[model samples]
Target chain A: MAALSIKDLTAIAKKTKESMQISAQGPHTKITVHMGTCGIAAGAQKVMDSFKEVLEIVDKKDVILTYSGCAGLCSNEPMVTIERYGEKPIKYINITPKIAREIMKQHVQKGNPLKEYIIAKGYENIV
Target chain B: MGDSTMSKETKKKEKTQTIPDLNSVPFFGRQILIALRNRGRINPESIDEYIAHDGYQALAKGLTKLKPTDIVEQIKQSSLRGRGGGGFDTGRKWASAAKATGEPKYVICNADEGDPGAYMDRSIIEADPHSVIEGMALCGRAIGSTVGYVYIRAEYPLARKILGHALEQARAYGLLGENILDSDFSFDIFIKQGAGAFVCGESSALRASIEGNVGEPTPKYDHATEKGLWKKPTVLNNVESFANVPPIILKGAQWFSAMGTEHSKGTKVFSLVGKIVNTGLIEVLMGTTLRDIIFEIGGGIPDGKAFKAVQTGGPSGGCIPESLLDMSVDFEELSKAGSMMGSGGMIVMDEDTCMVNVAKYFIEFCNSESCGKCISCRDGSEAMLEILTRISEGKGKEEDITLLEELSNAIKEASLCGLGTSLPNPVLSTLRYFKEEYQEHIVHKRCPAGVCKALITFTVLEKNCTKCGVCFKNCPYEAITWKKKEIAVINQNQCKKCGICYEVCKFKAIERK
Candidate 1:
């Protein structure tokens, strides 16, 4: 691979951001699976695989999938949070592969939420 | 149709009532993520995801916009102190390394985190390895060094693998290695794994281990910044400290300094563990109170137990009692209260936990980990551990406490390294705070918390037994005998005083005598 110059860095950052963005502003649907050690111990990897399978079947191009670290509430592991464009993000706790499929079908494909598994709505005010 | 409409209406009501706002939860609300900014937002394996979140922007700015001296000046202005327990001024360390006469200076990231129940460094590296890399690169630019080394432990295989992958990605992107960002500056980082020795976390011992020598600390007659890593000027910072650098460079120094107390700047990540309900990694401002961290962020003690004390700074730190829960958790305040903030390991204890046993456990750890290079540390820790053991076993004399204090002072004064100096903090701080618990053990020959097996006996209270049979079923030994609809009887001869029945009893029927 070739070494990137200073100008190339800004260009790459801009190009990646633009391509990764689903809409002009941001992704229309974003899914963040908490895959920290705590979360993985509670079967987050299975949950992640389930999401991949569901996304493949549904074939939603506007949806962005990613994984991050612990969300602090370790007791509620294998947690997944979904954010729709211009809507409050909803966090679902103690998720399973079956639940992941249900969530992808019901919440992601349709606008209605699976209210029973939802832990919280909206992001924590982190300063 | 009428049934469907009714179900839909009920679902709407339940949704509104059950889904609470995230900010309303204290565990999530109390934390601020500056150093852990990319933790739950980006995939660590993907450098493109990191770049989308402004990962290498700080390095780009440092390389293009600022000079080496200017970078050091900005950090100095930020007032960022070392997060790796000493609380030394980071910029001053960098400045001295920049000015010190040497052929080739070096940058070292101390990731050999050995604190029990503390995984903040490991989590940071696993979640966001680029932050540490970028921070180290920034430090290299400031200190005029081309080579950097991340001294990690072999025990953390996952963290090491992730960091290794991140380094490869950064090198491919021209963020690391020669001529980074096509500039005149060139810097590369390598990882060196330790054998997971507790004393190897010390700077001198870590440097010595990197040099393929015995992992023992020498006296810091000269600072590592002056003579370190092959006896050349070197700048060493902890995993967390280096991770904070990129943010400080990107956002102005004023912005970083504005978040923390007057003396300590920026946020600190703590691994909250032991008896707490929410045991996980949390980051809060430097001046956050123990009450907020323990009760609010930690969700208080579990099992409906009364809070006894909280031990901060790992085994090397001191146990703080209930009275000082409101104390501000800054570096100065903790040391003032007889505890130092040693790498942010907060272990909460409940009423069931015995304070004397707590002291013994930490002293035992320190004693075993002693390098034995200094007689004061090796022998002093062994002596203190003996006294603590005696006290916990209900055979302590009245003068034992005073003797432990004297030994603590001697070790602090005569020890060659930090391991020996802070070894007695657990004993000294427990004595300072929970002296009455110690008095109860020595004077009455009783373990009030029922922890010391030799000092207490278990008996089932008939009124609260409820014929549960939980103790009888759970006992590893056939110590408790019970029948249907009858109170359980503990066979004193057979009982080993293991307290398994005491823990398993749901009705609190098992009493210690």
Candidate 2:
């Protein structure tokens, strides 16, 4: 290994960016569970567990699970953001474990995001 | 020169790339994540994820292109100050260390955040440890130091674990150790675990603790930049301050400077806790008002309780009343309002929170954390704590008010470090803003907020009670007795005054008199 040069670092950054773009295009779905203190207070942990259980049941291979801090509007906590590749992200608020499982079953498995629990649509660039 | 300018312009252009639907993002309207840019967006454990989000690119840029002096100049131009309570200029500290003659100069990131309700440092470290590491490396390069130390508190186990992993990852990828980015400069970092002393958050005290001495603050007659850590010139900046470096270097000073107030540049991350509805870490522009932070970002106080006051800084900080809610939260502005912005602990106290008790609680914290170095801090804190305790317990004499103030001022005038100096703030500020409450506590012998346990009595109201068995089951000492379809009665004798029945009462039946 030729002592990682600046050029190599830049190239790696470029590769990662390109991979990010590719992931954004298709073949993956990203789930962002807000785990800020407020979210946790509103039962985000159980919501996250629900997401994990539902996702496992659906068994989607290309799903990405990540946690985010508070989104400021903590009133609508236990917030989850679901982004399907090549589409705008949807944000669901005031989510329970049952709602999370419903979301996983209806949205992740069948390409349809639940509208009732959603506070906002096309919230992809929010963070 | 033209080609470099073109690249710089392009970098600037790229920096301005906006995240679409920022308005739609639930809380993005009020939040500006500069220091916390990669916080929730990236996987903190993966260096690749960090890099993808423009992480170590700044380090690479600083190393390959900019000289050490140039990086320092850029920091100076940006007007970036410390976020670890002092609000001192980051560039000046680094420049002095660089100017100081030493064989192996040192850079230290002070992550020993010990504010009672503050976890801003720990959160940043846990969420984005690589950013902190990158910031440290950039500081080392700027200050001509080849080694750095991250003195984080042992209480933050998760942050420590993540930071340790981040260091290992950086070393493995050659981002740390042996000529980073293949430049002439080779920088490495080590973690110095603090023994959970609040005083160790002080600069020289932290330096002393790292050197295996008792964690006590020393008088700073000489600047730490000129003499620190084994008598070597050292640059010490806080976790948040270091985390801000990579962004400042990646973007220009102008970008960082553009976000905050005229004097206080860049964003501040506050752990908005206490009686607020949304209690979490929030990063907002420096000039953002306390009203916005408390009401807007914090979702106001929970359960419709009226907002009484918001306490900024920490145990060493003052309580700003609702009257000063509109005041812009910055270093200078906070000081003008009788409080220094001590490490971004914004604790929102509601109407139920008694200011005297708040003052007493903080004084107790200060008394415990005092290094016992000075007579005023040691004895004065104990005395102040004693008076506050007496006043809170309804044993306050009319003269106790003036006595507390006198002792608080004495401690403030004669203290070795910031901890001791700021010890008087909570009491003084509460006295200034909420004097009526103190008068009530002292002259009237009443706790207006129902917070001082001794001053308030818990009673079960028959009119409102719906035969609720909740309080009966919830009371720790079985203080409440209830038959079905009958009002619950609280046994004054058995009541430990724990207020569990009052809290658990569903019907507004439990009254505090």
Best by DockQ: 1
Model 2 lDDT per residue over B1-513, tens place? 999989876764443232244454435557778777776566667788788878788998998789999999999999999999989999898889989997688989999999988888887876688999999999999988999999998887767887899999999888989988778888999999999988999888999999999988887778788888988989999999999999899888988888789899988989888898766677888999999888887778888899998888998789999888999989999999999888999888898898998998999898999999998988899999889888988889999988988888888899989888999999999999999999898888899988888888898888888886899898878878888888888888787788888888878889997
Please report the candidate that would top lDDT against the real structure. 1
Please list the residue runs of candidate 2 whose C-alpha ends up more than 4 Å from where it truly belongs after superposition.
A21-25, A33-60, A66-80, A91-100, A115-127, B1-26, B466-474, B481-488
In model 2, the Cα lDDT at residue B61 comes to: 90
Provide the lowest-lDDT 10-residue window in model 1 chain A: A18-27
Residue A87 in candidate 1, Cα distance off native in Å: 2.1
Candidate 1 lDDT, tens digit per residue, B1-513? 999989987875566567787777787778888878777767888888888778788999999899999899999999999998889999999999999989688999999898888888888898899999999999999999999999999998878998999999999988888899888889999999999999999999999999999999987888789899899999999999998998899988998999888788889999999999988788999999999999998999888999999999987799998899999889999999889899989999999899999999998998999999999999999999889899988899999989989999999999988999999999999999989889989999988888888789999998888997999998998988999888999999999988889888889999987
Question: Best-fitting candidate, measured by TM-score?
Answer: 1
DockQ of 1: 0.58
